[model samples]
Target: MSDRDEQAYAGTAEGKGPVRIDEELARHLENKREELFEEFEIRDEFPPEVLREAEERAADPEGDIRTELEDRRDLRELTTWTTDPADAQDFDDAVSIERTDTGYRLWVHIADVTHYVAPETAMWEEAMERGNTVYLPAYTVHMLPPILAETVCSLVPNEDRLAHTVEMHIDGETLSHESIDIYKSVVHSDARQTYNDCEDRLEDPDAPLHEANSLAYELAEKLHEQRKDDGSLVLNPKRDRAHTIIEECMLKANKAVTHTLQWDRGLEAMFRVHPQPTPQEWDEALQEIQELDGVSIPGDAWDDPRKAVNATLEEAPGRQLDKIQWAVMKVMPRAKYMADPFGGHHALNFEIYGHFTSPIRRLSDLVNHWIVYTDGVPDGIGDLCDHASDKQKDGETCERIYKDFLQEVGLDPHAVNNRGIEVVDDPADAEYTA
Candidate 1:
């Protein structure tokens, strides 16, 4: 190798330096590693039978699609599109909008993953076992194999992919069940855009896909206002116009699907439930908030904690915002998948909610799809829900552990600022200095 190449590789190569890991950090890392494998299988390879079925379906994905022409709308000609992260591989959902005489007709198209992976199949069982995709910094463990998630079942641009659509006729930006219909659909996405571009073009009058993008922005604004009015918490730090648009669109679709499965069909399915915190937990959360922000909340704040939390966040100092939000979120109970339908989502302020958007990565969504199509759930659904909920927690734990390791090694995963702490020579006397 050349001298320059050797110099470039010296400090960067794997074995060039002796990495120092202190005893405390080392023990924590080891414990986290054990917890990871104990809770998650980390399975990546699919069985031969499952791969064979996926390949067969990929070849003729829509040959045997069972959408009734009279019932299901033929929306392939509509100007539909998807917006996601720049690095996203699986395109699971799309949106289309048009102005009607009464109001706006909005179409949310979700990829019909269950149409490919049927019930009681090997592929279906594997998906249930995986529960959902576990995405780490290095790699992703997809719930469905990549063959389907990245290629066939993904709602790619200009491709006619089968979908289960929620068609809503909005008058003045409100969604009513009377004007919404759920049915199978065939969609051809006009284009695929990224979240960054959507944000950039939020007000571009002549931007590509201007009509749909503009309408989506208006609808999302209304929905966001409604959510705030209904006492929903806005804890996400990265809330923006583009993010709000996509979030509201997905929320509308998920709410519609859940309403159909629970209220219309009365089918037994897994619901995404978020229970309210007990009085003790609420007291603890309030205590943490007071400790962080030094702002005392009223005793009656528990009645409408969303408003209290958001109001406190506005007054929270800039430097303490991140840590304060983290502490507050740590006190909140985790949302889980449940078989019961009546359990409401406390966070979203929904009376009923279910995972119905990304069947490509979530088994809970696939179960919802199965219920939609077959009008019944497969055997062992209760066990599947339990496993999925556990795996979801495991996935979060694994990501946290991995991110911690990355942060210690001077790599901030979010990349907002440099988090490189200085290392003391004694190893035992490690401390940070400006």
Candidate 2:
């Protein structure tokens, strides 16, 4: 049975999984499951065999079912996948490396999203409304249908998929490149290597996969080190959970997107930029830390602003930096959707940083890829940006309302009263504006 069929069965009564008390309870317990059924309204229940198969599929690390669903024949044809399975489908971008007299020419082929999602179509409308996919702990609700997001728009490897290729040449160390070309082309990904795996290989050249593909690994490290030496702060904190291969893969993809836009295409990219704390805010936070008399700055106060703040937090051992960072975020202009061709990313200290990869999870990246591919910005790029921002606000409002409702249901009086207030006891805010 297909993976979808198996998933359907696992959620049914006959599956080895514990039977639900009733439909209502089941729906209540499994919010996502209920939402899927209610939204799509799929009535047919899966067979017992299908449920077992789904269980097995879920345990599989590669997410084969999702890939299969994405690479269905009809979808493949629609998205222009004309390559063998092993060499095709699933990669959303490809990078070509070639040795040049001076350095190397890098060709980054991103999936052509505009080819599949035309404006005013249901898919496009839904995607725009969503702003982007919302990832929960259990499952993902895609902005577009599986066919469009997974198969057609995905720049899967080995497949002759349509792409907006960005070709450029890099000098010795710096990421200095010009936009060589931005046009539709058929291309394939040579390989799919995650960041952690790549890092491991870099640390140990004798690693299993390192022997086969050492050049890419070496280049990535060189690039990483170069960026760090040039004032790019490596402040990526370890996530709470152990790093999985899948998470590493996603990070590598994200990093590749940023590098391609900065190094391959001389395009100014919108980054998740964070500015240093202003003196006033910093002083206030510092005073608070000083009040904790025995406490000191956590670590070394390095030259880098990011590291300096992190070090201070480590020394002081308080939530001052967190509070200051949050306030500083408020003071700074929020990074929004934009098309910048000059290439300026102050946060990373790079000239460019754009989100071009992960079309499957982010609508902005999808639209950004389209803009890069077409060589000119999309007709309604500005409107899309505004709409996406508004939609994000709406989602946040909805989550807040839901949380408030939950608090009410759970009889949390304090939460109910402080539902919207950020600061309740600030005497100076007697005449504060909302």
Per residue, candidate 1 scores C-alpha lDDT tens digits across 348-431 of 778988878888988888888888888988777777788889988888777777778667755444331112223345656543
Regions more than 4 Å wrong, model 2:
1-26, 32-91, 98-101, 178-180, 190-213, 229-233, 237-277, 282-304, 310-334, 338-346, 350-353, 392-434
Find the 10 residues in a row with the least total lDDT in model 2.
1-10
Error of 1 at 358 (Å): 0.6
C-alpha positional error of residue 305 in candidate 2 after TM-score superposition, expressed in Å: 2.7
> If scored against the real structure, what TM-score would every candidate get?
0.82, 0.55
Would you give me the overall lDDT of model 1? 0.72
The C-alpha RMSD of each candidate to the native structure, in angstroms, is: 9.4, 14.0
Give the backbone clash total of model 2. Answer: 17
CA lDDT, every model vs. true structure: 0.72, 0.44
Q: Candidate 2 versus the native: TM-score?
A: 0.55
TM-score of 1: 0.82
